[model samples]
Target: MSLPVNIDEYSRLVVLDDNELQAQNVAVSVRERLQRLRGIYAYWLQFPSKFDKEIVDYDMKKFKVGRAQAYDDLHLTQILMGNLQQASKEFMRWKINRDLEEDLRLARQRGDLRAAASIEKNRIMNNRTDKDDEPELEFDKIVPQQFEMTDDPTVIGIQKVPGLRDRIRKLEKKYGDTKIEDADYEEIKEEHDGNGTGS
Candidate 1:
């Protein structure tokens, strides 16, 4: 005799996959598209008379909403901008921390005493920044991070370097751990002796 199969589970999966799941995915895609469109519209709206007929037509046709929706779009844009700013700041911080970590690992692997020390110090400072919940500059106020966009942009976040005293302290600690000769040590210190304005 053949055993009875639990056809209910199989039927549920097939039906959900074909219709409910597809509909949900489509709805999500539409929402995301609208969100992107709104952001683009808002960015252009930053300047007066920047809205061309094409943009207007796109909004009317794609969004299927009245021109009065600009008010809502503007409000949503402000919220989106604020979120984007926070996300960018967070991304920058993460990127700096990750880069320092990778640099430290590579320095150690290469036995580059001075480089390893400096990177370790930077990593420590990054950890401190995270723990301290450091305040970030306004998104637009920050200079763009120098990194390839194709790489891990989010993890390789942006950050301003710490002040001279802080950097010097870290450098001093890092230098103590290295086994460079006395002359080399002095040279390394000299090289790092810049007013702590560079990263």
Candidate 2:
């Protein structure tokens, strides 16, 4: 079966079997054009306040291209620079982090332990990205921890805990200096518990 194809589109393909030198010349011209375009792009990116006309003038003088070609190069450069990632803050941050990691790798390879440690420390200390060591926040655990909140003051100003409590004793030893009689502490504890009133 004959395939259906657009003859007009196929006619655009040229066979360059005889004109080899002309094909080579076209290839070289394209290469030079793209190189010039890339140079214009780099010049335009050097500063945010750089004017488009300045870039076009630089390209025209630098590459000896006409005003129209220089402006075309500037237009292409603007389109290339307009990419989402290239202009985003996150991309800049990621690029810096990647560069630091590469430096760290090279330092370690050369056995420069001090430089490697410094680079690694910089990567961690900078508040740029989410660190792996950061704990995943748990909503359920956000409830304030239940401690034995007491006001008797006996736990602190007592002689001995009899080890009745562990955490309370720790707090008392750390914060309290005065000590009370053990018998009186026990009586106060009973009164606070409402056991002494016998209501």
User: Pick by lDDT: which candidate is best?
Assistant: 2
Q: lDDT per residue, candidate 2, 1-199, as tens digits?
A: 1123233322232222325435655455545655675677666566545666687789989999866666655554554445232365456677878999899989989999999999977886664444565563232222333469875567788565465578878988987877765663343433344565643
Tens digit of per-residue lDDT, candidate 1, span 118-170? 87777776557447666742333324335455533346685545475678788
User: Which 10 successive residues of model 2 have the least lDDT summed?
Assistant: 9-18
The C-alpha TM-scores of every prediction are 0.27, 0.29
Q: Which ranges in model 2 have alpha carbons more than 4 Å from their true place?
A: 1-26, 83-199
TM-score of 1: 0.27
Give the clashing residue pairs of candidate 2, or none: none
lDDT of candidate 1 at residue 172, scale 0 to 100? 94
Model 1 alpha-carbon drift over 4 Å, by segment: 1-41, 44-82, 127-131, 134-199
